[model samples]
Target: MGKVAWVFPGQGSQVVGMGKAIAEADADARAVFDAADEALGFALSRLCFEGPEEELRLTVNTQPAILTTSAALLAVWKKAAPRPDFVAGHSLGEYSALVAAEALSFVDAVRIVRQRGAFMEEAVPAGRGGMAAVLGMEREALQAIVEAVSAEGDVVELANLNCPGQIVISGTREGVKKAAERAREAGARRVLELAVSGPFHSSLMKPAAERLAKVLVDVPLADARVPVVANVTARPVTQAAEIRRLLVEQVAAPVLWEDSVRTMLEAGVDTFVEIGPGTVLTGLIKKIDRRARCFNVHDPASLDKALAELA
Candidate 1:
């Protein structure tokens, strides 16, 4: 009887051969992959179904690949799942959420994400900028540490506010490295460098944001069928023009994941369905509010499990 939401996962959830099983079992899901291959003018489905791992991991390929997989999964999920009350997604997952909400066509979503990935990679020279996950620290303390490091003339800043005690920071190599040291000294449980190509979701990604703005301008957008919690604002945004603007700004802004989930809960979203490659969002939701119901549909097994839970 409570409101429900469909959330999607981002980059780190990708894996080789992610959607092959569902595509084989469902015609709708297969069409999603076929459309992606046609739109991109290459066998992106093959790259996802049978990846070389190395190529699939490239930011350019990874972006569209994850999008395609999540779209395919959503196609199958639609067969039995009821209409969701609202929708949201993590950093890269925001595009998936938009496509689901009918704010953007799937083909347009895939195309721009490919370009978005390349632009982000090109924004900062490889090995010069990166991200690290700092656990067991509060946001205020972490923000202060990042600010001190950035004041020394580097671009350190918070990237993903995933959940309490789990924050990711991004910036120049020296900035991230120094911040990690400071976070440890400040009593963080651990600081682990992430395997990302560049410093995403930080002021350093402004060049990428500039390039992405042009690509988003001509793309068709519609008011979301359901409210979509924006990553930049952690609030609902349904207007097409405003969605376009926030998307561009999202490139250089920290993902307010915790706040977004909390907003949904405050709006009475008691159940959350993660329609993507992994259970990352489900885990985050549990951490944010264990009383909220969480389920996910990735592969057939997970799909069945989720349906049973919903029932």
Candidate 2:
């Protein structure tokens, strides 16, 4: 059989009442939630199980909440699913990937993301920065366009290179608006603004990265048991020191998601498993390489489906 890869989702996957089903149904999954609550010194599990919607959506809470939920789902899947040969995550999902690799403990990861989110939110005030998705535009052309937008003295840069034609740009609000307009002029099919709290993965996030570096230096990290594809370079990362540096860089760097997926495919991974609150990574993997099989384990039913196929 071809190798299997396990992936995780980032910010946008969270919804009210995620992880509740698995937490109620399994001891391991429930313990993950309990551990998260204890580590973070709050009822994060309660927020994941019964979100007040807005509070859970806050970037500070959202980051740790999604991380905890993804970890909980992973704990459930590990009961039956075989160990993945490789792992990767999108944006905030990278921390979850590290946990899957055994490079970091779930408690440590949850703590880091909570602080990371707070730093990102604190980096730029509301309404001053933004992000927009440019569809149907090639990378080279979009790169030139974003540079042109940056030349205007506002900081605009490529953020998420999610797929072939789906690229997200982050910058000052004015800069992003101008970039979106230029993208439309440059023959992009559509330009849509995202409802994000700040301009993540852009120069505006440097302050966040600086703050994250301090947190990472003190945190304990081990070598990966499974090779982890990094977001900044789309290459396999195993060393603890390099992982620490790349994670800090990842805060303000474009997510090389397409390249990361391709790297695993080249490494002989043919099945992609997304264990998280949603199937976002599964869809992204299918878009990157259609021949690869994709599965998701969010709740009991989906967990059974993935187990039937893999276990």
Candidate 3:
């Protein structure tokens, strides 16, 4: 059997009709959605299934909705194939990863991410912070530009090291704008500002991380049945205490996604399966390692295809 790793995507991957196909086709998948509603004490499934787009895009709602959808898709996947040897998620998807690894209860994961979203949103006021993706730039060169443009009052730092030639910078609005200009001068092909609610995965979010630390203390975590590659360290985390610490820190830390994928590849994860809405993680993995096999499972047809390929 191929050494397999299951990965999940974060916020931007969510869409209006994400988990509807899975929920409609599979009873187990529907139950996952129902459980998420019970856990969050709201009609999250409704928002996901029938969204006005803006509400679903909110950080607090998006986090739990994406987690619930991803988890529901994973439930369908479990019925189709063997469990992966390892799991990982990008940013918000980390909660989904922990659930898949058996390190966190599904209901608790939902609640924590909901709180996490609220904290992140409230941490940085509207228009005060922003993020941008600097494409076709080396990480070192991008970092140099971010540092050069940063001022005493403005803070911009590399946030997501997604893959080669792609890096995200997040911080104060002025800082990000300056970094975007400097990045172009530093040889970036394009700089696209993100439509996000906050400057996530940057040191500006320290206060949010501090608050999450307290929340994590009360949240239950268990030893992972399968190792989970963490976004902060890009290493497998199994201990409950370590998981809590890393998750708390992850709010204000760079998402070491490229490093995480590289670590899993080095650890013999040759096949990557993205169990979520979009093919974003699969695209990122392909960019990291051309030889690695990666696929996505979001609906019944894709699930059958993956099972056939793996079988």
Error of 1 at 128 (Å): 0.7
| Each candidate: RMSD | 0.9, 0.8, 1.0
Global lDDT of each model? 0.93, 0.93, 0.92
TM-score of each: 0.98, 0.98, 0.98
- Kindly list the per-residue Cα lDDT of model 1 for residues 124-210, writing each as its tens digit: 999999999999999999999999989998879999999999999999999999999999999999999999999999999999999
What does candidate 2's lDDT look like per residue over 1-311, in tens digits?
89999999999999999999999999998999999899889999999988899999999999999999899889888877778899999989999999999999999999999999999999999999999999999999999999987997988999999988899999999999999998999899999999999999998999999999999999999999999999999999999999999999999999999899999999999999988998888887888878899998899899998899776
- Off by more than 4 A, model 2: none
Off by over 4 Å in 1: none
For candidate 3, write residues 40-135 as lDDT tens digits. Answer: 888999999999799999999999999999999898787767878889999999999999999999999999999999999999888999999999
The alpha-carbon root-mean-square deviation between model 2 and the true structure, to one decimal in Å, is 0.8
lDDT of 3 at 67: 96
Give the candidate order by descending lDDT. Answer: 1, 2, 3
